[model samples]
Target chain A: GAGVSQTPSNKVTEKGKYVELRCDPISGHTALYWYRQSLGQGPEFLIYFQGTGAADDSGLPNDRFFAVRPEGSVSTLKIQRTERGDSAVYLCASSRTSGIPDTQYFGPGTRLTVL
Target chain B: DQQVKQNSPSLSVQEGRISILNCDYTNSMFDYFLWYKKYPAEGPTFLISISSIKDKNEDGRFTVFLNKSAKHLSLHIVPSQPGDSAVYFCAASAQGSGTYKYIFGTGTRLKVLA
Candidate 1:
């Protein structure tokens, strides 16, 4: 089966611009998550969606970051007025359900560079 | 503050040798621990996991050991092969406490020489 997939593997934009990263989870996955990874650091949680609704958004660094999963399969991570600090590899993952011991399958990730 | 820490940035081992990676956490609330392997330009893939209730979990050549009292865990691979070389990340979640988001460590790069 196909694993998770992300589009626009690399994106470069100017500071204060807007960018959107897309994620396509495996078929039938009910839970999706977004994370950001900076250089020399591990991935930091961004947001999570259960079905079409976001179950958790506490990991969003600020109001500038937002994510949505309209139909429950594909998710988009949007960044408003991006800053140089926001440059990093954006990762997306999904699992059958947001239950304990559930394994998440990850996508190749989209690397965003805010110039 | 980093809730999960992988002190070693890199490790090297010969083929068929044992490779051990360690992780420590500052949060006592974390009950579910997981290990992930990542190749360059790719997102992390799940490798193994252990629950706080169990001291150890083994699968094939990979084993994960958890020490709740010490807030630590370790992943050991026997007969390491070149294919095993990659960055390994340890993640923790307080699933029992209702939080499903994971806190991941910086990651340790492993090089298996054949």
Candidate 2:
């Protein structure tokens, strides 16, 4: 893809439901990241992937919020037992280089609304 | 707590005038700062960035200035145009060598009125 692509631009689920959001990073990009943005706030760090392995998952709100990138090119962010508070825009970004100093390109994001 | 802060919630500028947006960060470890512009229903688009090492960077009509000692950064747009009206977000990252999980400031909404 020419840019980072995210699936299901919007999702509405009841509390306790499970949801999966997908991201297809740009070809050959070595780094991927996930972020959450609540109403009226900026994107908050959720997780980061250096390659096939997650380099940082500390930002995940809890164990219920998990993400994975089985192949270095694509990633999935899964949320289980979704709470109303979990409602927010889940954003995905990718960079050619894995790490901080690189410019990341972001996707349109999935606006998950937990009703 | 928000590590990155954009205290001004909104700014109104006249067309053909300059617009200045400011941001501040409490984390000294951030090695780089970036500004993104967003329109309604669209994802943010990268504008300009400045490294912690340099005080300023210029790109056409957009310029970014970083003050490491003050932990502050600012974006200047020359001859602000109505099309430039959008929400601007400032982001900072710590340990640029490892991850790009940046801390972003609450966006500042700028309206350039003609």
What TM-score do all the candidates reach, one by one? Answer: 0.97, 0.97
Candidate 1's fnat?
A: 0.71
lDDT of residue B101 for candidate 2: 81
Clashing pairs in 1: none
Q: List the residue pairs that clash in candidate 2.
A: none
Error of 1 at A80 (Å): 1.2
RMSD of each: 1.0, 1.2
Candidate 2 residue lDDT tens string, A1-115 = 5998899999999999999999999899988999998878888989999899898888998999989898788899999999999998898998888544688888989999999
DockQ of 2: 0.70
Chain B TM, cand. 1: 0.98
lDDT of 1 at A33: 91
Error of 2 at B72 (Å): 0.8
